[model samples]
Target chain A: MREQSRGPAFMRILYLEDNPLLAFHVEQMIEDLGYVSAGSLSSFAELKEKFQSLQFDAVLVDIDLVDGPTGPDAAAWLQKRGIPAIFVTGQAQVAARHHDISLGFIEKPISPSDFAEKVELFRSRSTGS
Target chain B: MPIVILLDRASKPELVRAELARSWPRARLIFYQRPVTAVELVSGVQSALLVRLRQRDVRDHIGQEMELRRELNHRVKNILASVTSIFEMTRRGATSLDAFTDDFRGRLRALEKVHSAVFHAAEGAVSIGDIATLTFEPYRLVGQERISFSGPLMNLGRESGTTLALCLHELTTNAIKYGALSQPEGRVTLRWSVIDGVQPELALEWKESEGPLVIEPARAGYGTRYVRSALAAVFGRLPTIAFEPDGLRCSAQGPLSRLSATDSSQPR
Candidate 1:
């Protein structure tokens, strides 16, 4: 089991999930695991419009959004900006196809352990450590 | 060359022979009347029809199976996601293992029962009356009825019904935990109706009364948040959940078209 706390550096996570319940649930889990929740947006469009103002260490994206299946495009966009994006989705196959853009994929119904482990990768990628 | 022509008994053999002779010259024309065996013809036609029917049945079954598979995949993923959320929320609220188990199981059972009702509904749509009765059924005693629901005949499509069910579950849970249903004298009333007009509108309300003094929580929890978000998603309008001194009252209204299964188009 991962320790409850990882020093002072709280990784701020921005998740893109269209489903409001899942978004809220994951948001709570993120906080419970001692991470900062940057907030959640339902569509890639919202992310693009609000990206610059939001403060976050990395992103967790779902494949399908309110607008369309633009999770891959969002990941690529974040990658171009030097931000690490990890996919959290039920469609693992679709996320795998875009592996070059994302740090990795966390399959949905995300357990706290799996999420905490994979989310640590974002920290390493962001800090170049 | 001997040219033999079998003509239907009803047809003129002479005319058909002339036509055949015109097409094929230097032919000794030998004409034979077509045999009329009704039984043989009927059986032959019946077998052909049976083969075609079997082919159609197989084709339809394959198509239906594929469609059902797609729907099942979608439903399973959604249900899993919901269950995960319920588990997380219940864990957050629980103070002990028993509490966690009780809360989680109750929520899950509510979801399962509501889904079963919606699925088994013959028309693929469940009326609001049925939703109310089914949702509150587990809580009711054999003789004493503490909770009551009244509503006009209003049907909801699958998505809307599920959303409503979840919201109702949250309300029912909250009532049991802290509001009306927490005490023997406490009571809950759920009422709903649709007002007919150029743009029909649906109105629903849940009221709790004769309970411990209602104190609004400092912050909204999973139940309130879920109710707010789910109702807004289905109705295109957010509901008002007020914690009054007397009791808790939740009310919402939106276009009826959005809630009904037959019509999903948003009112313009």
Candidate 2:
């Protein structure tokens, strides 16, 4: 068994996804990357609250949340707080708008391989070492 | 000819001296302040000419609007003609009551759904989600318990959405009648991919496992033929189909440009 790193050695990820099944799958993917899923929130309110309380290395947000507000709105809030976020959306048009603001985009049904690759990319940029 | 009237310092004396009311009674007049110098006079003439040109521009605009309206009417008529022809052909080909009703209603709904999507989409592009929702609404209602969908959100060009929706509907119909949705335990996996370096293609897998074992039909029916033909018509190319022991697998590949064109002149 691979030894688990105790603290900040593993990247901390804050993932906001609406679908429970997809959220679980993504959380598992985040864990497999030797990263800690700081927390996963489904609603905008919870996501905002978690962001305020936690120090996440990066965030992966979905475009359409089951609740009201959009993923970009959450990303914009994170941006105001100086946190880096990438949009994980199935909608190509929605992703296109993030060309200027986001770190990058990950298209959905959230393929395991694609999710892992994007997480690694975010981790590299956040550490910069 | 339209009359011109000038009013200026030089003309002021003439207007004051002459019978102003009588001279202008029946004449259409344009008034201008008199220019002090030769250069000013030339500039006044140019300005007067520009006003006449502006009037001509208004006339031209009216003419163009008429032409546009005519073209729009022509296009609408053509769309109706093509839709009528398709119905006629389908009616002639359909043998039984069930086949005719299924094919007719399915095709009409497909056309209606596409029309609605195009109407709503602003830049000739519709969200893939909208297309999926519209096409699958009927199936979802009919097979509420059986079928489920999972995929990344993707948008296709408005015209492409229409084609994609129709193709999906046809596939769903086939599954409902013979494949997965026919049984209680079976399901479909619908997914798509957009690779950066490669041409964008949509892959939809209809896997029907843990249900009744599917035996290949002795011969392809009108339902199968219509599904194949409709997909071909949309892509403007032949689609490939594989008969697996588990379920039916179909793949379609084509240029995105062909799929994206929104010109209604193109046949649906």
Candidate 3:
């Protein structure tokens, strides 16, 4: 969370998406909204090995990934790493189970307004204190 | 009412009447002294017995028809649910109106193809090998040697069969678009074998070669995503897809308890 609190504070977002097309589309969406895509990964096992190297202020996770239902675990992993995360997924009920760990969720076929609002919310969260 | 017991000409009437009355104690027995002809029997009380038996037969037939109707209704509901799920999931990844239409229709066709295979199957389960054949049939028509699959005679449950069919459809679609089957010299091999342990597992491997060199893309495609979800949902495990410099390779394994009734999914 404090990564963006530093000098020039770019909102670098690491996305946990297994679908390359969706990942590419969402990466474009993130960049179009004036945020940097730190990188994208397909599974939790990959995230576990590489989270330290990726330079990102926050993470955008989907509830289901290539490695089964491990998005909740990813969110919890980010939380423990002192980073904030948000779920961008179609499985509302399953994501809600781990909503406490993530700051919020942005649903699939992501609405631009919702995407902007969530990003603002995440940024404001870092500046508040 | 006196219950009459007809005695053949060879039998004495008094003795038969006594025996019948002893057995059917609540009814009075009246034994006839002479044997009746078939014509006489049809016109007598036996006609009433024949009518009752016919009525019972009609009732049994009706019961069987009702049972068949209920089963057909249940199967129709299952098909509807399965189609709806496939449509909903496929709709999520489509890029344009045309893309969505084509993708959705293709997926439905895949489901329809698998349904026909299942219908013609002699046993309750469909063989995995048949599903692979149906999925790659279009490519095979072009060049028989271009694509080949070999697997054990593993049978899958109806739902699992549908899931596997859809997964194979995605893989075949990808191979046609960008993988090994995209060129004349390219080829794909899909092979599987059951591994025995505390639990038997079905291992599937899809390998491609002899085409353009492959590279991992910046993002995954719809086919990859569908295969992952369908496999995970059906097999309770995720497939490993590696984009090697030479070609693409994918492998996954899960317990046989998912589809087979017993461990008979493995080769004998």
Model 2 residue pairs with clashes: A90-B153, A91-B153, A108-B152, B5-B30, B128-B155
Clashing pairs in 3: A20-B219, A20-B220, A21-B220
TM-score of chain A of 1: 0.88
Please provide, for model 3 over B50-156, each residue's C-alpha lDDT reduced to its tens digit, 9 standing for 90 to 100: 66677789999999888677556534543554554455556667788898898888878888898798778766478899898887786676547777889889998
Clashes of 2: 5
TM-score of chain B of each: 0.74, 0.71, 0.70
Local distance difference test, candidate 3 = 0.73
Residue A9 of model 2 has an lDDT of 46
Q: Taking the candidates in order, what DockQ does each have?
A: 0.21, 0.01, 0.03
Off by over 4 Å in 3: A1-129, B1-57, B141-144, B262-268
TM-score-sorted candidate list, best first: 1, 3, 2
Ranking by DockQ: 1, 3, 2
Clash pairs detected, candidate 1? none
* Consecutive 10-residue window with the lowest summed lDDT within model 3 chain B: B259-268
lDDT for each candidate structure: 0.79, 0.63, 0.73
- Tens-digit lDDT track of model 1 for A1-129: 133434425688888876666876877777776778776776687789878788987889998765567888999999889778999988788899988999889988887789888887876654556
Instruction: Point out the worst 10-residue segment of candidate 1 chain B by lDDT.
Output: B259-268
TM-scores, one per candidate: 0.65, 0.51, 0.53
Candidate 2 lDDT over residue span B125-231, tens digit each: 77666776777787776677565556566556654576567667777887887887788777766655543436665544445554457777887654455445445
